[model samples]
Target: MASKQIQCEICFKEYAVGYCKTCGHIGDACVDIHNTGKVFQTHSVIMHEAVNVHEDDRENPKVIIRDASEERCKQHATERAIFLCTRHDTMICGRCLHSEHLSCGKEVVDLLREVGSIDCEKVNTMKSLLMEVKNEILLLKDDAENSKENFKTNADNCAQECIELGIKIKQRVDELTNVLIDEITKKHNENESTYSRITRTYNEKITWCENEERKIDQFVHNNMAGYLYLLSRKFDKGVSDVRSNLREIKHKHTFKRFEFKENRVILKCVFEDLEDVCEHQDEVTGSDDGSVNDVFEPTTEIQKTRRELTALSHKAKEYLDKSIKERLTVEAELKRTKADLNRVEKEIIDN
Candidate 1:
């Protein structure tokens, strides 16, 4: 039968019977010999440089390895971070230990050890806080949506009330104006009738006096002295009667101009009061300071509804602020947890 053959991994030499005399056994012994040979090669290089370099120039291989293996401190960019300053919640280099963190009064732990010693309990606590904050935010969102709908409803109601009030005011103004116009028109018609009657009576009196004068003139012209003398007293009596009637007409039907003593001051005051009502409505409707009750003077159901809406708005604002605060806290904790998890993951990979 043919002997089994194996190859040395380090020397790449073929062997028989699971061993090679030149490179030792094929499995564990050859692996150890190869590793020891690498260590000697590294030691020889270090020793050769140590003989040629000054004591200060000879950097420790461990420090060089650590510096090469780890990330540098951000604050001290050229120095490798070796410790975690718990007080400042920062990774620091060896130089920072003797400088900024010397009297910081907190534990400074080895970064690798600290990463290895991460407590799952703290991560769970952070998760719990995050969940609570998320739930609170969701509740706040629901409350905000409800508040928005309620505010819209309140606004619609207030607008309807304003529109109704405006209509009523216009109607009242029209009623008052129409009543005054009607009264003035009636009075004007009566005054015109009285003027026409008096003018007609005065014209009749003038016509009768002219006819009597003409009769007197005809008697004088005809030289009928006896008849004229007899008719003189009648004529004078007729003239006197006509003059008396004229005087009576003048006294009874003198042209009296119509005047409307409308209560304009009272109307103006009503308008001013209406303006005040309008302004109060604006104040009530436009207020955002949760002062609806103060602005609207809750004497009616609409005002009471507005007050309730304002109270709801205030409550919504409070809840929103609380939710925001919780969200910020959760985000901060999540950031910290992520950084811790990353550190733990990196440590695991390194180990």
Candidate 2:
């Protein structure tokens, strides 16, 4: 008789489930272990315990392997394990579980197992989408490069314009300043000359008045001592005789007339019609002299000229302000262009 079944590893217990009780691994004699095939049977208990592994219940016992597919490994011998998602026109990995597409309904392993017989239309669509993204990115890169070059060109032009305008403004300021100084100087010189001429004329008039006063004093002295006595002695005569005597005395006067002309003087004296009646002869003579102006002050012409210069200076400043505003506008445009170029560049990099 054959020996009754006995537990080899477990003492005092028979093997009931056809698996070892010590390690929990299936027994070597079981149909489940023998019929499952080498691929599923060689896995350790650890792997079986982690997954819900089971036998296929078809007419024929087919061994089933879990989580085994090309998508999980480098099947194409490339770095990327690309799985085409045709519905979304994207590529994903075995770890991706996108729910957008019916084709992604299967697990990553089953999906890669059938990658060879995938729909041709989905593959074509994925390739078309990749090509479109590449083309768009290339166009955007080119546009960004062109924009940067254009901004550089515009900035250079603006810098040159600013330099040119600044030089022009400085030159204009210098020219205007010189003109104003020269005009003011000329006005000062003219005013000084006028003041000096007027002062000289007044002084000459004062000197003439002093000389006339001396002459009147001498005439009065002569009249009181001799002519007055003669007149008092002749008071017994008629008034008409006294008037005739006074007229005859005036006909022989020494200093008689002083005349003034423009910035000059003239003297005239008469001794009646007698040529040898007086000791001194009558004559007229004058001398012309002048001096440099001591001080200068602005006249009305100077004030008007200064005002006009101020107006011109204000106009120049206004033009400078306009030029500066134009420069600022150009700078603002350049800044905007730089920002646009940077943003476009960033977009390209991100893409």
Report lDDT per candidate. 0.66, 0.51
Kindly list the per-residue Cα lDDT of model 2 for residues 1-351, writing each as its tens digit.
Answer: 111232422233433233321233233344254346565565333212222323333222222233323222223222234565555545555445343334555433334556546688998999999999999899868866876787688678777866786687679769977887777677667666656655665566566557655655675877656654554464446345545544554453223232324332211211231222212322212124423223343333323343587799999999999999999999999999999999999999999
lDDT of 1 by residue, 1-351 (tens): 111233443355633113322332344444445447764343211100113333553442111112211555677755668888888888888898898888875588876655666589999999999999999899878877876788789789888999999999889889988998898888788789888998788789878878767877898999889878888768778778878887887788655466767689877966675655744342232246633324544334334344587799999999999999999999999999999999999999999
Q: CA shift at 137, candidate 2, in angstroms?
A: 3.9
Q: Which candidate has the highest lDDT of all?
A: 1
Q: Give candidate 2's TM-score.
A: 0.30
In candidate 1, which residue pairs clash?
none
